[model samples]
Target: MGDLSLVRALGRGNIPVAVTTSERQSKVGFSRYCVAVVPTPSWVDDPEAALAAVIAWSEQQREPPVLFYQGDHDLLAASRGRERMAGHLRCVLPPAELVENLVDKQRFAAFAERRKLPVPLTRTLCRGK
Candidate 1:
């Protein structure tokens, strides 16, 4: 839903939008504003493969395109591969370590606690303990 909305917003702004998704049923590919739909490997399944696909797609573009990722897997893949992706694509992401910490619920809880971010109390449960 958010992806679709983003496509629409960017399209309305005259931005050339390209959507990268592994899901065949993803509606973003069908969006009228989408200039291209690049099929990528599922980042959760193969981060390296997905990042490679993204970089390969960027290589076809006249200029490095801004990359917008919607989920944690994509975010992590982009963050970890920031160096390799530097000349191929452009992304606005936090530091890789911060990206990793924010994606893990327990780690995010600890991070927030350490920073006194005013988040609600967070507790982790261990199984078979």
Candidate 2:
């Protein structure tokens, strides 16, 4: 869904884009906005390897490209390994702490409540006590 949105938004603006995916089967590569597709390991499966692959992919470009992450795993890894990837690619990501807070929904709920953010009321029911 994110890929489709990106293709539509960027393609309409005539912005060049390249996509990367661990699964060669990913249909995002077929999008009209995609100029190229670089293959990389799934961050969830092998974070270190994926990070290496991404950095290498960036190095091949004459200029660093703005990265667009598709999921929590990619976002977290990007935030944690920002320095390494920063040398070769431009990325816009939340700080590590914010990523952690969001990734762990419990922390996010507490934060939202503290900040008085509008969120649906939630209940935690214990299985047994």
Candidate 3:
């Protein structure tokens, strides 16, 4: 999904892009939209490892590239490792407090409600002792 948009943007700027996928099947499809396709590990179960791998890949590039995150889990893992990875890559992310508030549905709704903003009706569900 991100590859297509990135390819289009890079093409507009005449920049070369490298797309990495974990699955062999994904490479064929992504290759058509990217300059190169590199196979990477699936970071589903181990996010730290995935973050490390991506950080390592970014460090190898001579010209720093913009990184875009498409998945919520991946975004969270990257946020947690921001201090360690700050120098190696650039992450376009919302403020930490904003991200935190948005991720928690209840907190987000309550905040919006407090401000008299338009938010859906929300209620907490609990198990009584």
Best by lDDT: 1
Query: What's the number of clashes in each of the models?
Result: 0, 0, 0
Poorest 10 consecutive residues by lDDT, candidate 3: 27-36
Model 1 deviation from native, Cα RMSD in Å: 1.7
TM-score of each: 0.92, 0.83, 0.74
TM-score of 3: 0.74
**Model 3 alpha-carbon drift over 4 Å, by segment:** 1-3, 27-29, 38-44, 127-129
lDDT of 2 at 30: 86
Q: Please give the distance, in angstroms, between residue 127's alpha carbon in candidate 3 and its true position after superposition.
A: 5.2
Q: How many residue-pair clashes does candidate 1 contain?
A: 0
Give, for candidate 2, the lowest lDDT window spanning 10 residues. Answer: 1-10
Better of 1 and 2 by TM-score: 1
Residues 40-103 of candidate 1: C-alpha lDDT, one tens digit per residue: 8887999889889989989988999998888888888889999999989988989888998899
Which of candidates 1 and 3 is the stronger one according to TM-score? Answer: 1
Over 4 Å off, model 1:
none
